[model samples]
Target chain A: MDSVRALTLIVTMAFLVLAMPAEVALGHGVELSVAPHESIEVNAAYEAGEPMAGAQVAVFAPGEPAEPWLRGSVDEEGRFFFVPDSDRPGTWEVQVRQAGHGGIVRIEVEPAGVVEVTGGGLTPLQKALMAACVLWGSIGTALYFKRRAV
Target chain B: MIGIRTTRMVVLLVTLLAGILTFAGCAAEGAPEPETPAPAAETSDTGLLVFAADGEEHAREGTVSKEGWNITFEHAYVTLADIAAYQTDPPYDVDADGWDLAYDHMVSLPGEFTIDLADPASDPAILGEVADAPAGFYNAFSWHMVRAASGPAEGNSIVFIGTAEKDGETVDFTLRFDQELAYQGGEYIGDVRKGILDAGGEAEAEMTFHFDHFFGRADKDADDPLNTDALGFDPLAALATDGVVDVSLGDLKESLSAEDYARLEDILVHFGHIGENHCIAEPLE
Candidate 1:
């Protein structure tokens, strides 16, 4: 009875395996496309596609392969966008990796040439001043003109 | 006269001040800075739209046009190894069912280019209407389908990739798939059955049909010029990756001339779809 039972189990296992289609899991998928010149700020990352989150980005100049030109983390949108050439020139390759993960994506970075972030990020005070100038100037001029008309 | 001039000056100054304030407030709202000959960057309005069907992202389109149909397909279950770039896996795995799909389209949201539907017979329901897409999302409101033809109808599915610009501005563009057949139920297919039946009820077992995606200068750099063989986009070529796709396209491809085939293929190759796994079928009947 034991021998017969064992045979039955083996056959069932074989059959099930045969009936099942090959299941291939997708690895990390990355695409390389030229972002518009203005939206060139970007980051390249690599990670095992599973967890679907928490990947870090490291960009390096292609061929140089030593130190990364830029490094950062994948945002909530799984993206890391920085000025492509923070004002420098060289073919770059951005790679993203996360801790406790395996999967590396290497993408080509054509020379974006150069870019300089001249404007400091908006400061609250500066913003307020610009607003006041436009608002108050217009209001004051309008009042003065109205009074004259009257 | 001098007093009147002084008063007029006062009024103009007041108007200028008010206008400045209102405009400044708007500026404070953080509208995109006007284009200032941005340094040689890819493009700010430029972005990446990934069409993932089956289990992989086989094709990557860098840009899309707003005036015409932008399609993407992820041939999963179907044996489609010969279809596009990177024939790295078996065409289809029948055992594992999937959310695999064949196409995705992202028409520009704030489509501003006016298009003249040369065909008066186009479905009037969606004609000549400007679309308002929310910022940060594709907005040319659309409807898509993918139906089954063998035994019973299967539900087709579609999703908007993202919106983009047609020109620097807004306009209406219409395309029709009638005069041949329509693909609405997810408009996805996995076989060339249509081609077999078309070959005099013994169709060529290959699917063929015209595919169109109008382009501006930018799209030409992104699309497969080979698909636009006639270059002028004459009678478009019908293609088949499976017998079912062929069966569905009917004789529409035959309607196109060799010159037309040449023209379309020329333009399509620029967008990636090139070579034999994807072909311009001889109008066999």
Candidate 2:
């Protein structure tokens, strides 16, 4: 009876060893998608090409409360929609966590007909001033040396 | 004569052009109206410092004997500070007891200089030129003697190294002075001194340190002596020739005689100043 019990235990251990890899592979497959609209729509999925339904998500914006600007779970199709406050502009941070893994992404809010001045390019006034200084220096140097030689 | 006149004409033209350009530059920058210019007058300026070993002009590299030992100075560098103000005549007197020169309103040159006292052909090292300096007769002036920051004697300000021979015995001696010459109000005084400086004209101060003046006298008690007696033999001079004596004063303190040690201390403190008749201010021409 003791030998039979030991054989049964060995069989059960082999079965568990063979099953662990498949479980890990299934858990690791994650994908995210967002749809563009007046309100942002977020979508998450796994590598098996299946939607990750009910995955938790949080959103934050500049000057928003620390306790997540918004929090919810993905819908049946692994998607969520967020309508940012009308006053909110600039960058929005979104965090998604499910099971044992998590990730974050940023969204930018730029209005139409608005432009940013990076200040990396030179202005017309600055270019003119530089040219004038170079010309003045060249003339002064040539005349001074000519006078000295004579 | 024609060349000289042409050069003068060119100089005047350049000056006029420079004046116009200066005004134009200020106007372009939207500067306010220019202030009234000062009246034409003479100004006292520090032009240069002339070095001589003894009374012989430009004799920087030579030997002088004290008692029986030969002495030579290889390098001498110093810094000159601004002159103290005197509201009344007979401006200030030298205080022999201690440093009583008021340090207030003292101005210093930008960088310390090592004048080439060993080269007779070399022009005196530049001290500084002050264009806006006051023009007048200065009663007295003060300066500082400092150690070199780098080179052979890296930290030493005064280096006098040479060979001394006596009684058919020759020995090497070195006096690497690291002590700073602090400015005292009345130390190293020159007599009947009046330096006239003119405005826009170059002038320089000449300070000649007579190496011969240092050796013949020794006083055992004073830190600095106003004068040294020729009759008294300075022990430092004797020790340089004698193998039994050491040149490092700090380590060989017990080996030196009381009088020799005192004289060495005095020389260390007061030997570098521009002594009487040795310092002067004159026009650059």
Candidate 3:
């Protein structure tokens, strides 16, 4: 009877595992969902065609209509996260990629805003001045040497 | 003819003597010597800081402050040595006297609209944060609000801040100072790190040890002096070597007091970078 009960428990455990859907276990193949925490989830795994286990993920936050924030790689399953906790808010982005799988996603966080400041980096005139000075110095040195030789 | 030959021989001997003297002088000149100043204070502004760090490698020309660092860049790099405002011995022994309230850290640059955005009256976006910038900031003259050491933002006011621009970016970076001496429940982002409170009955204040990077790390190198608490680093070696750039002290001093000056000075001395200097080959507005 004890051996029968043990056998019954093992069979029941195997049956329960088989009963659960792949979505619950492996997540319907790495789809995305938005949660109330202002976060996006990407259920991930070792995708087909390649191992897809340990790929590096780098996130470049969306520039427009978004807050610039970055987060990479979820847990062992392959999901990642990005939370807009800063006072500066806008559209935020989270990107996840590993080995040979995954992709990028864009999310918009609202209300708290940012001032987009745009200006010339290094002006052409400044670069020109520096170049001209070096050029003039070279020319002057050549001229000085010519005169001294004479 | 005898007189002529005598003059020629005498002239020859004199010339030989002079030539020997010149050669000896050259040898003396080649010996190692200390730096000599330009008679007119070096009007030749290289716009670089080759000599810094106690004037050992470079002589500082511009006034370096939170607003900007101006150096006579005869060379390619600036050597900035850390300067400390206060020094105290180990453990809380009564023998250990507190740092005197000299207020060594002072900074005042010329800018018009001063705002305590940390104040409820105004709420300016922390522009520096979005820029992936350091924790400190400076208000452009006539643009952002400059914090007042005495007036509205005195002691515990929060406002919009930023420095100038150089190399296509803002010069005023933020120093994530912990102002425990001046605010309730700590008016700083100390939740990420440890800090100390200045004793002043009720009017307390605090400071972040060095410039806080975007990833929330202090710039102090591994050998940073502060421990885990009382304004220290986690690993202590990551003190940032990159200092603020762009604004000059003389320009900043245009609107600062002795106290404000000292406070700014002290803060930079502890947390500023050595290789920091600013240059805008671009047109100045």
- Could you tell me every candidate's TM-score relative to the true structure? 0.19, 0.40, 0.16
For model 3, the docking class works out as incorrect
Interface RMSD of each: 26.9, 44.5, 28.2
Winning model by lDDT: 2
User: What is the C-alpha DockQ of each candidate?
Assistant: 0.01, 0.00, 0.01
Fraction of the true interface contacts (Cα pairs closer than 8 Å across chains) found in each model: 0.00, 0.00, 0.00
Residue pairs that clash (backbone atoms under 3 angstroms), model 2: B42-B198, B42-B199, B43-B197, B43-B198, B43-B199, B47-B204, B48-B204, B101-B185, B147-B157, B148-B157
B108-207, model 2: which lDDT tens digit per residue?
3445555545445433444454444343333234555565566655565555555555566665656555555643332122221223334444333344
RMSD list, candidates in order: 28.1, 34.7, 30.1
Positional deviation of B54 in candidate 3, in angstroms?
A: 35
User: Per-residue lDDT for B180-259 in model 3, tens only?
Assistant: 11100111111111112122111111222122211121222222221111121111112223534222344334434555
Number of clashing residue pairs in every model?
107, 10, 65
Model 3, position B98: C-alpha lDDT score: 18
Better of 1 and 3 by TM-score: 1
The weakest ten consecutive residues by lDDT in model 3 chain A span A5-14
Error of 2 at B195 (Å): 2.6
Cα lDDT, all candidates: 0.27, 0.42, 0.26
Which residue ranges in model 1 land beyond 4 Å of their true spot?
A: A1-59, A62-150, B1-250, B265-285
